[model samples]
Target: MGTQAIIRPTTSQTAPAQEQNFGDQFLHVFLQDGTPVAKLGCGGSHVLNAAAGQSISNNRWTPITVQYNLPVGKQGGSCMIEIATDNGTAQRLEEYVSHPVSEVT
Candidate 1:
């Protein structure tokens, strides 16, 4: 079989305020091939990026399933998937918190 990237299942958790907007959630998976992967869902904090201080909402859930199709390597790219109740809202933060999912191998 051809070489492939072994993606580990990562689950983040957080508790957002009830008053906060638990909009739609999206994920961006960066591959070693310099490609980007995006997925849709819902949760608090909206954007799914690499943060030193961030957590996923345990009460919030998204109905989007993100898939990644890329090779495995030590050198990879970055990704940025925003979240919001409407796509238009997410568009506002797409430029910020760009998450980079690089292969540690």
Candidate 2:
């Protein structure tokens, strides 16, 4: 089974909490440390370098998609990410992750 979410960031982005929780998140997306990121199972972290903060942090709704490919046995995991910036620029990434997709996802 799969899951989906729609996030429309309000123009009110304040500093993220010093201790952001990724513990049980399947797809955790946030802008802490001035960088935009999307994390996977067990909240495996990855940078969404496609769009800059100014491009995404507005009242405009930028769409981002993340898909996980679970690991087999001892093999690692991978993810497919796509983002459409509010400005007509499109970004996509398909890469493997250092950690396996945690069931916690």
Best by TM-score: 2
Clashes of each: 6, 0
Maximum-lDDT candidate: 2
Q: What is the Å distance of residue 34 in model 1 from its true position?
A: 35
Candidate 1 versus the native: TM-score? 0.22
Candidate 1, which segments miss by more than 4 Å at Cα? 1-72, 86-88, 91-105
What are the RMSDs of all candidates, in order?
15.1, 5.8
- Candidate 2 lDDT, 1-105, residue by residue in tens: 222334455555543211224353344456543334544443345433332234455444444443344333334555554433334443455566565545533
Local error of candidate 1 at residue 42 (angstroms): 19
Residue-by-residue lDDT tens digits, candidate 1, 1-105? 111122332332222211211133333333212212233222223334322112222334322222222222333222233323211123212222223333322
For model 2, the superposed segments whose C-alpha errors exceed 4 Å read 1-4, 14-25, 32-36, 41-54, 77-105
